[model samples]
Target: MDAPVSTSPRPWSPPPDASDVVKSIHAMLHPRNIVVVGATDKPGNYAERIWNNLIKYGYEGGLFPVNAKRESVWGVPCYKDFASLPEPPDHVLVLVPARLAVQVIRDAAASGARSATIVTSGFSELQDEESQRLAAELQQAVRETGLAVTGPNCLGNLSAGEKLFTNIDDRAVTMVQGPVAIAGQSGAIVMAIRQTLEDRGVGIGYMVTTGNEAGLETTDLMNYFVVDPSIRVIVVYLEGVRNTKAFRDACKAARAAGKPVIALKLGASEGGRAAAMAHTGALAGSIETFDAIATREGVIRVQNLDQLIETTECFVHAVTPKGNRLAAVTLSGGKRGLLIDAFDAVGLNFAPPSPGISAELGAMLGPGSIVGNPLDAGFAAVVDPTVYMRAIKLMIDDPDTDIVIIDAELPKAPHELRERNLRRVNDMAGEASKPVIYVSAMSIGFTDYTKELRQTLPHVTVLQGLDRAVTAIKSLIDYAALPKQVPDVASSSKPSARATLEKILKQAEGAALDEVDSKKLLKAYGIPISKEAIAQSAIEAIKIAKSIGFPVVAKVVSPDILHKSDIGGVMLNLTTPAAVGKAFADITARVKKLKGKPKLEGILIAKQVNADLELVIGASLDAEMGPVVLFGSGGLDIELMKDVALAGAPLNEADARALIGRTKAGVKIKGYRGKPALHEASAVKALVGLSNLISDAGQRIASIDINPFLINPKTGVAVDALIVLNNEAARQSFDKSTKGKSTKKGGGH
Candidate 1:
């Protein structure tokens, strides 16, 4: 097949007219005739091998060699060049230097050679001026000729069963003619997996290494094979997907075709995945997002290539283990039973073989051998080898068994004993057409022999990590019995910004958000709070306190000072006007003494709040997900515990309500210790509203602080509040501030 030479600019891309190039090159991979460009008397040239492998593998199709410098290299008469070929061979495999390879491709395209494989590199990797020129010019050539590109820095492709073989070290290309097609960036992984597949006698339809993915990228290959009837399983090994539309569409197409696509995309860690994601924002599709998409789209996303293979092995064998329910029949009852317990811990079901089968089993085994669920045939199988066969047939007869797991352990009498039994049951199960899982306890004891057996029973998957087997079971069950939707209850539309106050302080300039600024943002978002006042002096503070009644708090307002105690900026517990005067005097003197601290705007007094308990609700934007609401045990424990769950912004209010349900404060508020239910629903609703508001503000929110959100059975109010605006502070940062100093926690010296 012709490999494409990149012609894109600094960040290489396929030519403008690359579709036809890709199609034609794709066609050449399965060509009837191949013409070798630069065919010579060289012992191991790429072109020579192309011709030899084509013939060596019994490709009865036509072979044409085009060379400007040699004559009769492979016995078939060689032509001077492509122009001299009998009829412009189907594909021209060009083995030339980087400078000359581009023209050779153009000549091949013009001479009717559908595609050209430029098996030369030094194009973009070198970062040299000429290589860049060559890469761009080559890409232009594709636009000029509509020629498809495989790679300029790639190992090329191989489809062994179709006789499309090339020794490009794409590295260990195996001739497995199965139903899976693999697309990979790492030729080494592709090679390793191909070998593993071939070892299992599995066949492959297409294998491509899209290194750098210049043109005719991974998705093009995916899109093409998705429609191909012969391919039913698609495996992708990726550093990343450059085009989301193409990648998604290809996956959709595969699903539409009932093809199972197993992907091992590595990103989300290390520089490679990050680089892959950052360059294209391909979503490197983080694990959570990827799993969600794959589940929704019917794509099986695996972690590494090994899991990719293991998952594929199950699909290829058509082993659809639907339910977690498992029934094991092993040679050793103890070993299989132990495995069953392990499976249980992993959330796997151990379904007992039905009664009728047990009776039928009674006749097969002597009166002594116990034959029930987890039919302990392992010990009995030793006494009677044929007993294994009887147990298997009876187990399959039971309607209760969805998957029959065979735990064959004890060493046999050795006449190719395990193989014989395996063949018998394998053939039986093949005819039965039911899912059968195998775990060789005997093989587990021996590494070499175990590997050997695995090679033979390639259809049987050897699940990794006992934990992994459970995970696999759970995933499969979930797939079969997945729910349509996860319910979301709208909890609140209030801004959950209280914890964000610190962020605001950092960006604070000379002026701070006044109570009006703080309350405006909160009020606009619908968070309920007390009515209040911002009086400046002792007399004014005393009058406001008397009106709000005896128990109001007073504090000096200032953007300059944070800890009100250090500066005597706050005065609390003002039951009498005389007490208020003395508190007011203390705040005024302290403010006059502090540097870089704002003078007291006034002593504000308002209705003081007394609630059952104080709960802190806040919002913080995560590095990935923008804004998140966190609710947990409040007070000093907040920092110590960090026992908080984060939920995305624009949160469902019901989700907010649910968030409280997840916290310890919820139990207290919901009537623990006979405590009446606070306005719990109202508080949660407020938090949810805050989360949405902050999310909408996005970068505009620098921080917010609504500490000690007082909650009682009947009502909840934020006693203290602060709002940090963005680079440019929001004018309405405190719309949710107290109506007045109906608060405590005042500044004090």
Candidate 2:
């Protein structure tokens, strides 16, 4: 069969000039020289402002203005073009149309200026076919010339140490230089965050906005950021990711570099998804999907601009909450209560300062401050603002307290005093490299001071709002604790992605398997099966019952009555031949009554096996996670609990064991309380055994339901199982079975 038709766009791609554009932004940071391609005094032109801002911002780089229309722009002499420059500038800033932006970059690249900022929009995102064609043509030019572009619609980039200047917010222009490097797709968002950083008085190393992300994607720019010694914290405002594999690799590289990447990713809703597809011609990896990959890959995803900035700071500044412990220091009763609720919601908690220290802090302040985990430093700060420092020091110094959080709003009277207190508290936290979260109730106050503190103490992550303050801390804790990758079981049997299994998984179809067929497929996979002789009639059923054993389970094994008990399709616990004969007739008769017709497949007498616990595990293809295994409470209601834990199959013993523990059944399977535990480890091995079988069989199995896999508690034998066979459905059954084994006994099976 042919592959499905395409609907999602060709992943978002910026023009080759896009990086050249971003490089232009990066160049402004420490450019040897900057050449303005469309320099002019025209009121609407960006030339005068660019020239003026370069000079005003104290850019030491030489400036060359090029405008055929003017000899000077903002009092700077203009060159006709790049050929006229005395020496090539490190960056060529272009504020021209799309067609001209390409030429500007080509000129720059030819002149050894390999980077150019294109502060011009109107390309593919505009949905103008002509413009898109032009955009593609321009992109080819940059690629051929090997120059990098930042944006055609981007606001431009920034580097504080380089003293690079573009149209970034003026407030951010005043911000100092530091280790954080921001690569944003949304110019407005990056600038806003820059402003926010500036408001907090934090210094930034570089701010790159990949407008329309035409060429130098966030990952491409980050590729350099991960290696740049000057950048410690990487913040990104992402509209969309063009290449996930590239991003995943970059994230791994960044993690190894010890650089915490805080990302503000967009495109969550249906409309947003459509826009993402259209804007960049890229698939909108949904928020949750993106989160899973990012989390797995070590990229911290944040929601809003606020989350973007705060999380970035925490990632850079704070260590993981050592032991799920937080210390909340707040003044107001309401604030403290809110903090508690927020902490609970986020799955983090305040470890009250140790009794010895809590007592000491209380004594120092006496009746003034309510010293507890949520230390009410409010009352004490009024008496001695240094009490803020004292309270913070108390929390940070506490051996049991891993994280200290101050949720307070201090007035601007004491910049020096607060800085002293902050640094003192900073020193205390620095002793053990502990983390501190400062939450200013209002967004307005202490912007400058907060910035100063964050810059001084890279680990002191500050935020606005009580909820944000709490959530950021908790998310940091949780995100840090997440495992890197679940163990892979497919490599267990060294299963080489057999063609047969692939075909089975890709295209299989069938209803539930008959018991005999289930065992036949298991036999193919090297799974053991019970010895049973099928009896064609009541006489045969009794004869087989006696031949097999006296006490046997006479089950109505027919595909018709899938739920045997509902229609009296099963007759169990029979010891005598006479009883077995009666059960054979009764079960078939009952089925006839229920369905108005019953064609007996014959009665099979199977040995009755004692079980400690029933495990139900199988696989059903999850469109998202792929052929994932499932484990849950066994018996009929396995559907109801869905108490499943899964892993992709071809599992090894270790992977199988983990798969068992991953389910709610771990404790129960291990034997809970006084009850004898099932042989989970052995059962896991059995599961691995079965999965390898399916992997080997290829196209033969659809789904395997190890329902009521009467596991012998003492010996841990998987005494009974049902393997469904059909098509690709069976290929996925391996995972479903592994995930479906149970813990809860239910009312009864």
Model 1 segments more than 4 A misplaced: 1-28, 38-40, 77-80, 113-118, 124-145, 169-176, 267-289, 358-373, 409-417, 441-749
**lDDT tens digits by residue: candidate 1, 1-749:** 32212222221223454455345545645665666667777777666666666655545456677776766776767788767665546655656788887888777777776655555676765667998898888778866877666656555567555566653442334454568888776666776677666554456877776654445667778776765556778887766555544666667667666677777766542211211211111122244334433454556777665556556666676465555567777666577667777777856767656777777888778787666667777666778778888888777667777777676532323348767777666666675545776654332333445545555554454444444444455545554454333333333442345334334444456323555456656766777776668777778877887777878877666654433545666566778889888888887787887765565566556567887877776664322223445565554355565444444455666667767886678778788987677788768766866776666665555445565578887888766665544432232222222124332110000
Off by over 4 Å in 2: 1-30, 168-172, 268-285, 316-322, 330-334, 352-372, 375-392, 415-423, 430-432, 441-444, 447-461, 478-497, 501-749
Residues 218-258, candidate 2, lDDT per residue (tens digit)? 78878677766777878887766656557767787777776
- The models' CA-based lDDT, in order, is 0.60, 0.63
Best by lDDT: 2
Residue 282 error, candidate 1, Å: 17
